[model samples]
Target: MVKVVQPAYGRVFQDDEGAAELAKVLWKETVAALKEAEAVTLANLARADRYVRAKVEFENLYPTAYQQGPVLKGEEGGEYFNYRWSACEKLNERMLKLEKAMFGEATVKAGREKPAAGKVAADEFLGPDNGIRQ
Candidate 1:
């Protein structure tokens, strides 16, 4: 089982098994999406990194709720609810940014390969013979 750092919600998962399973699923989906976009670069890779982080944080929110059980009449209930809500908000924000970067109007410019030496310029209308033909 993979071990992730305890989220701000604190240690929610009783064991690493659940977290590891979730992480694996997220990783596979992230990789597939990246491949489809042909965005295997370092910069785009960072987007996937953000997604994984956000997902793990979001998943921890569930375990937190489970551990707390029903929310009784107390400020603690409100606080716990607020914290989980904040986590959801943050995860949504990250996902939105990632989607925009992956499929938005932004264009990726690939590096141009230099033409080899001795290549004739296509604009050179005048041929090697140097003059207009009869």
Candidate 2:
């Protein structure tokens, strides 16, 4: 996952390309969807592994997106900031609460040639791996 941390100047954008390539190793269906040059972005990649979008969204939204909803709006007005902040926090909460829905087990290996890279499968929680099983 560290390999996927691309600093977006001031903001942090999830590396969908890295994720997709990593997915091709850990995720069963990602390679098929990302087969061609689809401009590997989270939205496009989500077509294959939907949980990826959730995790990516949660990652990009926090600490700085504390950027808009609250980061910028905190000085605007508590009421307005609260609204945006709530929305932002709500998203974060969903990512946390819906960990199972957002992430689960790896179905199977997509194949070889694709190394595990620095990517962690969804099983390891924050590192990746879709869900926490019982």
Candidate 3:
């Protein structure tokens, strides 16, 4: 298991237990996604560290958005703010880039492997001489 560095913004959470729980969940999710990409290499894990930090920061900043509304209002002329939807979008873009780096491409390229010389095509076996109709 690779250890990810804590995000500087995570300090806002304050509760050690809550922070630990959040970290655990993030770590597991990241590991699972990396595994699915067949990219559980050390280099990929290191790349994942950045994604984890962004995710943790996002979670810390918008903790109540799921339960409440996406937008959160500030009190009495203080600094008004909304949910971190832009941050979430940025996180998604980063995830896509990471997956592409790890997994090559979303679609497999054609002719990546060529047939050996003198190999018969499978269609040949279904020809008339083999007693199979097209």
Candidate 4:
């Protein structure tokens, strides 16, 4: 006879034996996966940040503006430009891949009414008050 009101979603789930069982199994696995994904995402972020900082230092020293290939005048002086461009490209690719994986899984999981335990519950979330629509 107990109903756990999901405050944010305005839905409710009965705190019954069946619900408890489902939560025990499904939620555990989902949370574990999310944790692993988060770790990977964090590592990627750190690596990207380090690379960007290094690139900035290289830019200051080399000063791509001084290269005459495109603006100043000759392709030989633009080697630093190529290096910086490629490094930035690689960092961006890594960031995009990590972000996509993290966000895609989260979006799919959000649509389900009964997500596993440790996952964000309706009552636990707060947003613009448009419910999940926002």
Best by TM-score: 1
TM-score versus the correct structure, for each prediction: 0.50, 0.30, 0.45, 0.24
Candidate 1 lowest-lDDT run of ten: 1-10
What is the C-alpha lDDT profile of model 1 across 6-28, one tens digit per residue? 23222333366676667657766
- Candidate 3 Cα deviation (angstroms), residue 90: 2.5
- lDDT of the structure predicted as candidate 2: 0.44
- RMSD (CA, Å), candidate 4 to true, equals 24.2
| Model 3: per-residue Cα lDDT at residue 134 | 53
lDDT of 4 by residue, 38-134 (tens): 5435544434333333333344434453352323324665524455445445655654554454444344345646666745545446544626563
Report RMSD for candidate 1.
Answer: 12.3
Cand. 2 TM to true fold: 0.30
Question: Which regions of candidate 3 are displaced past 4 Å?
Answer: 1-16, 62-83, 108-134
lDDT of each: 0.62, 0.44, 0.63, 0.42
Q: Which portions of model 1 show Cα errors greater than 4 Å? A: 1-15, 62-81, 105-134
